[model samples]
Target: MAATVEAVIAALRVTLEEAQKSREASWKVEAVNRWIGQLPGSWSGRWRRLVLKSDASGNARRDELVAHVRAVIAFLETNRQQIAQSRKWWPLRRRWPANSPIANAPVAAPASSSARPVNLLRVRKPMPGIH
Candidate 1:
């Protein structure tokens, strides 16, 4: 039960971090607000009182702020992988690359430091003028 709880928390943290990065990188204010809006009141309230108050949107501290955010995201990702593996989620563990589809069984192991580039080319084109 503890493992499950931790896994759920890790998953949510990853989701929130990705949402935040998408918003910051793309100027998606509505998306950012929506992500916050979906959170439980207590979580957001606590974060606002703690991190947000300390993290005034001042340009002089921009680098420090961004670094802190990135650190949090890194921590989240690490724990998420740990919790998933502890639960024997093969798709998350025993895989050469973290995001690759799980093989039927462990075949060949790849170095953890090796980075694989993801190809994002999709087959279908968007309906005209959608973006």
Candidate 2:
């Protein structure tokens, strides 16, 4: 009877250890899921690549996952100002059509009398057949 009790206790200890490991793994997966979900749209592709690399690494430590999230957050924060400025100016700096009047015209004088006139003519390229 004592031997049976000892065996049962040993089995219970193994079961508890396995349960704890399962719980920890579940928590880590949930944390990674939350981090991925919260990642910015612009950063999703990078995050996906990180996840693939991490999976290939086979070292799914919680700290490593958190480190990746923090790194991405830091990168986005550091570049946020530049990214915003570029987005703000991108549309305004669009390429002008070659045939537009503004493209063909010389610079006009500003309306204010004190403003100096500027020359800004487009240089024409010689035709291939005529050259």
Top-lDDT candidate index: 2
User: TM-score, each model?
Assistant: 0.25, 0.31
lDDT tens digits by residue: candidate 2, 1-131: 23332333344344334434553442234433433334333235433442313354344554454455455445545655554444321245646888888788889785777776665575576889997
Candidates in order have lDDT scores of 0.42, 0.45
- Best by the TM-score measure: 2
At residue 96, candidate 1 shows an lDDT of 62
lDDT of 1 by residue, 1-131 (tens): 33543544454465556554543432222322332333223144522321322323322233444454455445435655553444332234454666556644568886577676656785566788886
57: Cα error in model 2, Å: 11
TM-score, candidate number 1 = 0.25
What lDDT, from 0 to 1, does candidate 2 have?
0.45
Flag clash pairs in model 1.
none
